[model samples]
Target: MANNQTLIPVAEPVIGDKELAYVTECLKTGWISSLGKYVTTFENRFADYCNTQYGVATFNGTVALHLLAAALNLGPGDEIIMPSLTFVATANAIQYTGATPVFVDSEYGSWNIDPAVVEAAITPRTKAIIAVHLYGHPADMDPLREIAQAHNLLLLEDAAEAHGACYKGQRVGGLSDAAIFSFYGNKIMTTGEGGIIITNDQALSERAFFLENQGRYSDNPYWHPEVAFNYRMTNIQAAVGVAQLERIADLITIRQRNAAYYNQRLAEIDGLTLPPNQDWAENVYWMYSVLLDDTLPLNRDELRQKLRAANIDTRPFFYPVHQLPMYDTKQSLPVAEDLSRRGINLPSGATLTIAQVDYVCDELIKILT
Candidate 1:
């Protein structure tokens, strides 16, 4: 165990002076509600940053996806295909629409939804495919796009973990028909608790905006065309978002540098598989994850315990959605199941220092060795 008592966190929001100033201004101006210039500014700036035509901010990422489902008119018999390895919110969003979520396995190469498995899973009931950019790496989008195009299905991206990640020289959010981003505190850019839907389709953008604000159109006051949700992001959250967006490039750089340092130090260690660095993709390393080789003496949980004892915090990867009690099934998914058991997220916070990374890595190596 380290002599130093300073606890290294697994993930944290990097709130700087700009965030404080913007939030303070929002409070001083009494624009802390959903109706404020900060919300509009944040939507526009974030949309522009992602190379999208429009952005509709929402209360959170899950609600942003739920709004997308509502806009798409998904319900009852409609089915949405997604990887079983991602956060439950992805599947839950589809479920909220009264739609069934079809589980697909992830690719071992990138640890994202396997496009090859997607085609076989699609049926007449399939409405769309939610390709998640898992662990900051973009999924193999070209083939997924081709599949969507061939089947006349909408291709959506879950870019919750990939703020600045890119695939084949294009941004992940712009590559799909529409994409959702989570601005949760631990994400690369934070809005305290918020999300945004980015799309090139004006109709979808307008519908999302309308549905997010209690189904009442701005032009038509007190007229409810249909049941909707109050999923609007508050001005305070947007204020923080604008500031975080301003520093996103720098934040991404810091994460990349930290990941590189970890790679250098941990690559030589046996019984560990580092996160992938694809030639066609630039991963943002949202959480620097590794899969413990089966040969390792310690299991993933055991290793985490050892790391914690050394004052180095870590997190386990998400369990397969299909395996969860809420969506229990007999269907077998070998890759996702294997990854869930073996993968562990090291401390990859953007604010983490090089020395801190070294300490975490040294302790990790010591435990593994």
Candidate 2:
């Protein structure tokens, strides 16, 4: 243990002088509300970047999902097919719209929702399928879209963890009827706390805007309208988002390089599995996950403890949502259950250095081997 050594973090947001100066300018401009210039500018820029017609900014990623559910008119009689291998926010958003989230297992290759299972889950009441591109790996979109089309279900992409990811030469955020992105502090891109919904449908985009700003559609501020939640992103947050967007290319590059190092070093280790990406995907890994097979000398939790003892931070894969106390609805899933037990997220952030990645991989390999 040395005082000179800096701890490598599992996820860290890189906030620099640009963000600071932008925030200071926002404060001085007295346009810190949801209607500020930066908010409008950020929306336009992000929409253009994604090659979509519209982008509506929200307070955070969850709000974006909730708005998407509402925009699609998903309700009490509706059901959503999605993976249990995602953050609870994915399920919670569907729940907010009074729709049931039918959880499915993860794909063996990409660790995203298995499109095969999503098709099998389709029913008369299934109104949507939320395809989450987990950990910056673009979920196989074409097959999922085909399934949704067959069932006449809406297709939504929860690209919150995949800001710069692409699939089959198309960007993640513009792939579905509606796609949502998060600008949470820990994501590949950050606005401290913000999100956006992108779509090519004019009606859906307008409805999302209305829902995001409290369901008001009038130009007059004093006009009252139907009930809607307050999910608007402030000008201050948009200002920061604009700065982050400007640097997304560089951030993605850093993430790719760090992920490559982790994959190369950890791939050869017995019983250790790296995050999987398909050939068509340009992965911008938000977190580097390594699976520790049970056949290994130590289980997942034990290895985490061993790594932590060496001052290395790691996170086990999310506890499958179906296994959570609230979601114990007797859903039978074998793959998600197994992957959840074996997966571990290594330190992967835009600010991470090669030396830090090497340190993490070396320590992990040392323990696992």
Candidate 3:
């Protein structure tokens, strides 16, 4: 066994020689700022990879969401429906546009926003639905698309955790009207801190570009037409992102292999529920999250404590957004509430070795048994 003091983290970005070379070139060329060829190159390449027509690079994922909201012209009295079992950024992005975020429960099977509940949550004030691909599994998009079309509601995808995931043979980023991706240090891919908005609509793409770059109708200096944001991604970040994108397939394979190793070893254990992979979905396993059944001898937090003592880092799932103090609502979402209390994310970085995965599963089995 590795030393007990050698902590295995829940996630880590894989930075290699190509990333170093790219960033070093950026530094040597003094193109480290927001304006450079690397930024445009990375945007085009990433958008193409996701089968989108255009990409608008941003300072970070949250800002990308905010940019999308701005492009859609969401404002006061408007509503955007989203799952409560998600990172706070999803809700926060909607609120940024002066729109109210309506919380919906997650489905237990996929841990994504429930389409049935989504329809029920919509009111006359609803203008959009943010379908978050939680934990790298694509949400049931076909039904959501149908609902969006029927109601004339815009369907936007929060694909931050689902870089290479697919549903019904289409990539997550292309399944909706538009999508946003995060390149945070711990994501499947990394740019230190950057994000991009992808869309097939040309007008929406142009609008996002205009909004992110201070609302300049043209690149000409000192000509602002409307209120906008300074949410541009730095060239240094894009350099890293380009290198990361080059190896995205390999990185995803490594994560999936590690997850498989854990699944095989941990399957026999009782009181543990493995992450779900629906028949129509290709899960990228952003983090190999599992739920501890309520009947387990130890609860999720208790298990996390045991793992921590053994130098194994684990993370609890997000607290349902509706329950958070800032957006506190009396709405009771049973599935999201139950899953939040029991779910835990294991060590699932792309660079994690089979032996390391075995160690984590062994430690978890020991704690549960």
Candidate 4:
């Protein structure tokens, strides 16, 4: 490893001039708060991009989930099924409503929730199934959708990392009863920090909007019918979002291209398993993830330390939510644990260049050899 090498970030947002212009307009007009044209524009455009009929913008992804939970009347007695191998917010959202989040294992093929396991995990109390498009790969939704319909359970997507990803021919965010997306600094798109819930159900959309705005009805602004949180996305955030949405295709394309290059270089490496893109899915490759095979002499953490020493940044896969201290249930989901232990997210930001990818791979090969 050389001492003069530049560090590459694991993920980064792509911002442009349109974002600044939109925000500046918001400022000149004194519409800095959530009330502004950009808000609705971003909501509608993003919803339309995802092939959804409506979108309810939120301060962040977690609140979007909470709002959805609240809108659905999910409470203490109910349960929602989701893959254990996901960001904590997925489970936290359901937990916020006093509803239980039942954890399931992931399948090897796509590194997403196993539809078979999901079906097995369902119980009478289960009200919904959330299929997160983990690391940009869509979960096998058709089977999950079938299971949901047969049992009369709602299906949802946590597509925080999977902007523009698609299943079969249809885009995400509209595949199920509803879906949520994050526009944090690290997501494929950036709004600085924001989120949205997209769905075709007009009732759910209206209810979510009502809940996010403190449950206030327009006719009675001062009279709040029910207690709800103020979870509105700022005009500034939406300004950035609308700008990013305009370049959404480029954002997705560059990442996919980078992933292809990574796959080309890393595929022959015996101990590395490249990210998956199923035939039925169009992966956005939100993060070019690879798993460390047991055949590798060094473990995942050991390799990460080596890459860090070489001035190339990386991130380990998230700890399955169920294994976290608060959510610990002594359940043994072998697949998720194994993947978490071995998976690594390389510098997958949109701005990364080919030379940077070459440098990272060179260092990795040296370390592995």
Candidate 5:
């Protein structure tokens, strides 16, 4: 177990001296709670980065999604459409608001919600569509936007995996009516553990902010008129986030470089299909995934085990939410089901080196051959 097969984790969070120093500074300043300069600074800077008019920081990404559902007033008897291939949070957010989540399948190529399926799922009760840009790839927003427009439904972007990504030259966070971003430990960007909701509408922004901070108005922090959850991001966490935001461009560039290397090295394998991107999409490559053809000698789990045996770390694709225990009542999503069976996540942390990438690809190819 101690030979060349030492594990290379699929993702690693980078917390350099800058982040630590900022946290120390925040601690010394006695402004470590949610109400501090760093928290406001982080929100402002992140809003600017997303090119949106406002950003409301939350404790984590799930809270952001919940807040969005609440802010949009999606509740019992309403319906929301989203891809079943995403993290369960996407669907659970709807359930939190007492709304039903209509699961849609992914397009075979990009692993995003298929527009056709979305069109088919829309009904009179459909109030919104959460177009999640799964695994850092931008969903085809143009057509989805058209569909939403035609039906008079809100299009919300779940850009949790797509920081720094763009669709047709527009930033992902501001491309839809409202967008949510996650800064989880393994995400493309990190605020230690935080999220932001971006919007251009002042009223929506105000509602989102209010919901995020226990429904307390900025004018009267101590007085709460409505019941709201405490989802505010702390100043200490925001300090780390501000530092991470400063280096996001560089982080995205490195991830792109690593993904390109993987593509170049693994493109020749007979059993694998690489990620798909639209001509107009500026993908940030949050995670580099591959699909295993059934014609291949080995299946996805077999390939993953072989790689793990060789010290390379990889992850099996997300299990479609429809298949999960809690979502057994949801409708079937064939495309998402198929992708879940075929896909695998390769090592794609921000700190992955060229040599490490080569090692992962080399091991992957060896198993297939």
Candidate 6:
């Protein structure tokens, strides 16, 4: 989607020469399937980058989450806590394990899962906390970790959107018991479509790898030990991942740069709230998200429509999981609901030039002011 098209896209991948060369190598060697050198290399590279000990590559992030859930043996009578404001996949992954997803409200400062609310939600059956690094800002993990320790519960990160984002001084994927990341086409980095489980826990890492590969041992390929999934990432995908990882720093820097420019320009719009940049967190600004306060003449959807007319694409924040049909618990989470109503993701992608951003800002100013 990141191309020189007429419409400025909300997000796009930045593919380069290295990606093509690596992919070509996979094709030339007939190692297009999951069995190839790129898979292990990519896994090790990503794990090292995250300061973690292991990485189990998967076809996508959702399965990586489900894989972890299975490895942990979560099932009925267990509950997992997470913010209501995140994408529904977080809740679905828990549901896949037959575990209930206990929803919590978001904190105003980071628009992330609230630690105080998480503590309150814990019960005898509560098994873990899935702290999502929303939009690119890390959740305040220290308090959450404390609560988890106090309750004897595991803490995990759903860092699909916050690759390279830092909490305090550490990167997100290495901050918990285990974390997962999405390498989707529109993410900060891309492998076309892929994901991985990163962690320092030897037992959990071994379990995840075992479960992802149909639960069969290499020495006994003919014997099926347990029912599992074929969640392996393709060699081609890992090849792309390796190339993307090679220049991950540059991608992160560009996002932060774009965010800074957006902040300087769009900050002029009085009621538009800038994305969070905490003193202890390094936000990668994946989407350059902003919230539309009542002071603006147009609501979020209306402004999005006008931006559409101007050939600029944008995305509204996700509806809280509790509000969605599958998980409609009738539980009132005021902060998550409010942020979902007001937040919007602007054109934050590799293909978006400074000139395109200027056009977006000009259009917003003309329409809102």
- Compared with the true structure, what per-residue lDDT tens digits does model 1 show for residues 1-369? 333377688889999899999999999999999989999999999999988989999989999999999998999999999999999999999999899999999999999999989999999999999999998999999999999999999999999999989999888899988999999999999998899999999999998988888889678879998888899999999999999999999999999999999999998889899998899999999999999998989899999998888887889999999999999877899999999999999999987989898888888778888
Candidate 3: TM-score? 0.99
Per-residue alpha-carbon lDDT of model 5 for 19-106, expressed as tens digits? 9999999999898889888888888899888898888898899899999899988999999999999999999988999999888889
Residue-level lDDT for 84 in candidate 6: 98
Global lDDT for candidate 4? 0.91
Could you tell me every candidate's TM-score relative to the true structure? Answer: 0.98, 0.97, 0.99, 0.98, 0.97, 0.98
**Candidate 2 lDDT, 158-201, residue by residue in tens:** 99999889998888989889899999999998988999999999
Per residue, candidate 3 scores C-alpha lDDT tens digits across 1-369 of 454668999898899999999999999999989999999999999999999999999989999999999999998999999999999999998898899999999998799999988899889999999999999988999899999999999999999999999998888999889999999999999999999999999999999999998888665857987889999999999999999999999999999998888889999899889998999999999989999998889888888899999999999999999999999998999999999999999999997888888888788878887
Q: Model 2 Cα displacement at 86 (Å)?
A: 0.9
lDDT score, residue 70, model 2?
Answer: 89
> RMSD in Å for candidate 4, one decimal?
1.4
Candidate 1 pairs with clashing backbones = none
> CA lDDT of 48 in candidate 4?
96
Model 4, residue pairs in steric clash: none
After aligning candidate 5 to the native by TM-score, how far in Å is the CA of 226 from where it should be?
Answer: 1.5
Worst 10 residues of 2 by lDDT: 1-10
Question: By summed lDDT, which 10 consecutive residues of candidate 3 come out lowest?
Answer: 1-10
The 0-to-1 C-alpha lDDT of every candidate, in the order given, reads: 0.92, 0.87, 0.93, 0.91, 0.88, 0.92
